[model samples]
Target: MRTILILSMLFCSIGPANAAKTKKPKSEEQKTLYAIGADIAEQIINQFLFEEKERPYVMKGFQDRLAEGKLDIEVKDYRGKIRQMIVDRQQALRNKFLDEATAREGAKRFPTGLIFTETLKGTGEKPTLKDKVRVHYHGTLTNGQVFDSSVARNAPAEFRVDGVIACWKQGIPLMAVGGKAELICPSGIAYGKAGRPGKIPPYATLVFQVELLAIIK
Candidate 1:
């Protein structure tokens, strides 16, 4: 009976110690993973901070905002998902250029780059720089988001091709008086670095499936 009591107490006293010992391995593993993750996170954050530091105006803006003490930021769970959303959006935009380039390569080998798959010898009418042309067009972001469409709204847009974005300057010349074509415009040609707010952001390219309904003289 005394032996049983001593054994029971011994087991009871060691139980917590053993459980705690078991937890150390798991905690150590977790800590190692966390350290690795933190190192990776720090590297990314450091790179971003370095870039931000290069822009004194932006750094000043952040400092000004911080001084104003307007930071009531809430913690969001799913931070990885938020980061992934941004990365995916960027990749979505990038992939459009890749896809367009691939398509253009394939297209040059073919008769026409038209989605209609019809051979267009480009009537070579080549409208003037100041020419006001009426066209129906569908504009989409690389990620398949339709931003605008004169065709969808049942109205044709009046555009002086050259006066507008460079895409129009280059693309409209490829169209005849009545012709349909798709124009994949890179950011350099379309919106450039300064993009229209609310509708478009910086470094945004556009893909326009446009139909030249007429050239209004």
Candidate 2:
């Protein structure tokens, strides 16, 4: 009789109240790790070098490499040497580009007196540290690669006149609104030892023709 009663109670309790499992679900760390590993593998290796079928094998190797917390390439290994070669080539190209750009700009400017136009005689307004002003400009490297131009981009650049690159801070405030000026910034004032990619080479001087469009404040 007691056993029958206990069985009845058990059946009654097995409704929604007891259908829920009581213990907290354990975190599936290893499963999550594998999924994360698979995602990273798809991004780095599969995107760059591998086919879809190559993922598992590549993932297996990557997991093993990561367990050691060291990339084989970074330990003075063969892979490291190959990476170094690529870097060396990039640096060499940068140097060659800079030399070519400087030579070309030197040939184009100063002698013809075409660069510095002395007609607009308005004095420059020195801006305070917090003042942002609008300016129109065209920028290029000595190699004649035009990088930035407010007019070409059809937008005006607003920046703190007292806190931008040395060339800008020094050159922009020397002209009044509606006045035009030219700046030939050396590599030191421009994108110096490590030049901006593609357009400007490393250690390259920059040339700019700027018009002070308006001062916002």
Candidate 3:
């Protein structure tokens, strides 16, 4: 019954009638409804594609199940299973990347699971966790997708060391002003299980090329 209701709602909201009139100019009410439908569709696509590398296959499986009327499983149980699969895949990728990063020469691992390599040595004082500092950074996922970069913005970022992720709090103190380093962070020390939505995925390991500019007193 639930499956039927969901299918009915989907069909009523976005069916052949709507698709057939795509080239025509819509009234304000029709435009508003169309925007809402598009937004919902985009969110669903992004959620499925975010952690599922084989999203096309997953979507195909979903469509087949829906078409065949195989809705015996409860919705909550199905969602739980999918979530577990995504978590397992994420952990596998994170471990593989960490292994490769740690095997590199010149890389040093801290007891807290933060790994770093100094690219440029500095002679100035190092900032404490409580002290605010300015730095330029390029941050990426283990898969090399850059999620954030102060260098790209042509500006240095300033914040207290303790205010950032656990990895930054522990790794930044190892560098003095003007020093540059690359930090490889474990998920526990980075965003952990709940990453920044739409930017970083859950259980993601992060890599950062950071240049310390000032201790900011």
Candidate 4:
């Protein structure tokens, strides 16, 4: 008689709970909690590269914190060390890319550590530091991701030779008016440790295929 009464209570409790689970969050507090969950998932998971297998562990930590009201590990203890690891990894990658680029045929390492490889010899005059120049350039990262290209827009860029990045300031002088050359710029002479936030990353090595159109006087 007791077992039958217990079974009846179990089914009654399960039925409404299962029905409630099927409906979306309706209360303001429930909606806010859901929104916070969605935002955290997007920012942490999508913004960083996490392995598929690591997701369950991540959720476990999240669940523990919600249920136990405490973190499995303190973030302050490992945050600095973790940040340094990422920085060191990025530095090593950039160094390896620059080393291989320097070994390419016709590659010349100038005094500023810029690697210049001429693809087409120019017949006209080269631009001076003070000269305003017009040129088309296709810029990419070491991984062949195109970051910017005036050539793609079919509009040539005009700027003073001394006004651009250190790599361009030194590189433009090496190209004659009609010449095309590849400029491999290390981070120190390019955007440096803090690169363009959206367009580039820290410690990136840039490759620019630059064609000198004219030295605008």
Candidate 5:
């Protein structure tokens, strides 16, 4: 029933020109415009569908605004609301995961909310913040969704320890060359409020399986 309502609202939102009486695109320019329109519509649909169970209330609010005609909707207001929702959800999941992870025998948590678990121990010296290091890493959200991976690229990444996120600033220094460790970073030490947009959502906790290769000043 809710799905039907969502589809109905989507069709209605397409406007009268897109209704049954509309003519099909006839030229290249017309076709491009039609495609762009479809893309925009798809984005909107996907946004609502991301949280479909909560979308009915959102759609009802939108409908009320549309009916009022003169209602002023502030973009900042809605954006902030959405950001806060994402932050709250992400933080809750992060806390729960950290609790479970730190309960494991070998897992350790830092004072700054960074969680580290060693996979391989190394005998070489650890890198300092002033030194650049080459490493391979696979990064994911707390929900086990991979966001980025140097391992997947089959190339090691080189960067100064301090140049990366706050979590890496502290955690990487603890890892010696040839060591492999898993680092769980809280949002405050990761992307924080302004996440990597489409790649990482707001207030997302990041988990990285990092292998330290070489350190160079």
Candidate 6:
């Protein structure tokens, strides 16, 4: 559903380019439509973070569907495949990031693919799954775009050790109270295929900076 909506908006935005090649915009409505399309085009570019090499193929497909009323493949038959391609690409990116993160000095790669690197050592006690703890965390995607941050808000979050994602459940135990660590969670252990909608996409690898503030009694 989301993929369909994105493709629809992107293809609609191609109209302005076709119009530009033909003639100048003469009416207020045409000019407004052109501006709207330009904005949508910009949004799509930023959303995909598409590379220069991929732009031509994307524009060709859009032109074929919108301007030429033709398709090399049936849309209904290929939508699922297209979505899978996106998922696979995201997974590849995640794998690359995981490889680099695990190679970082002091990083520990667990069997579950969670990478933990302690930045600040703590002498205090560590919390178990049964314990509720207070902490501050900054969460981001592989691209370094922050999705959530208790640190930015200046408010610590409190929750049980096992109440969060699998990544945190495993990574937090490695930290003692007052410790800070970087947790790089592979998609399989962090939200997986069904990511937190609107804030995270499917197959996203999450990076987190976590500070264990206290273990609440």
Q: Best TM-score goes to which candidate?
A: 6
Candidate 3 lDDT tens digits, 160-216: 999999999988999998899999999899998799999997778889999999988
| Model 5, span 48-151: residue lDDT tens | 33465876666555566556565456645776676565446656656888899889878999889999999999778899999999999999987688999999
Candidates arranged by lDDT, highest first: 6, 5, 4, 3, 1, 2
Model 2 over residues 55-87: C-alpha lDDT tens digits?
Answer: 565444445454556553443355465455445
Q: What CA root-mean-square deviation does each model show from the true structure?
A: 18.8, 19.2, 6.2, 12.2, 7.0, 4.1
192 in model 1: Cα distance from truth in Å? 2.1
lDDT against the true structure, per candidate, is: 0.59, 0.58, 0.78, 0.79, 0.80, 0.83
Point to the candidate with the largest lDDT. Answer: 6
Q: In terms of lDDT, which candidate is stronger, 1 or 6?
A: 6
Worst 10 residues of 6 by lDDT: 7-16
Candidate 5 TM-score, C-alpha based: 0.64
Better of 1 and 5 by TM-score: 5
Off by over 4 Å in 5: 1-87
lDDT, model 6, position 113: 93
Structure candidate 3, residue pairs in collision: none
Write the candidate numbers in order of decreasing TM-score: 6, 4, 3, 5, 1, 2
Per-model TM-score, in order, reads 0.50, 0.45, 0.67, 0.67, 0.64, 0.78
Report the alpha-carbon TM-score of model 6 versus the true structure: 0.78
- Give residue 41's lDDT in candidate 5 (0 to 100): 58
Candidate 6 or 4, higher lDDT: 6
Which one wins by TM-score: 1 or 6?
Answer: 6
As a whole number from 0 to 100, the lDDT of residue 80 in candidate 5 is: 66
Q: Which is superior by lDDT, 5 or 6? A: 6
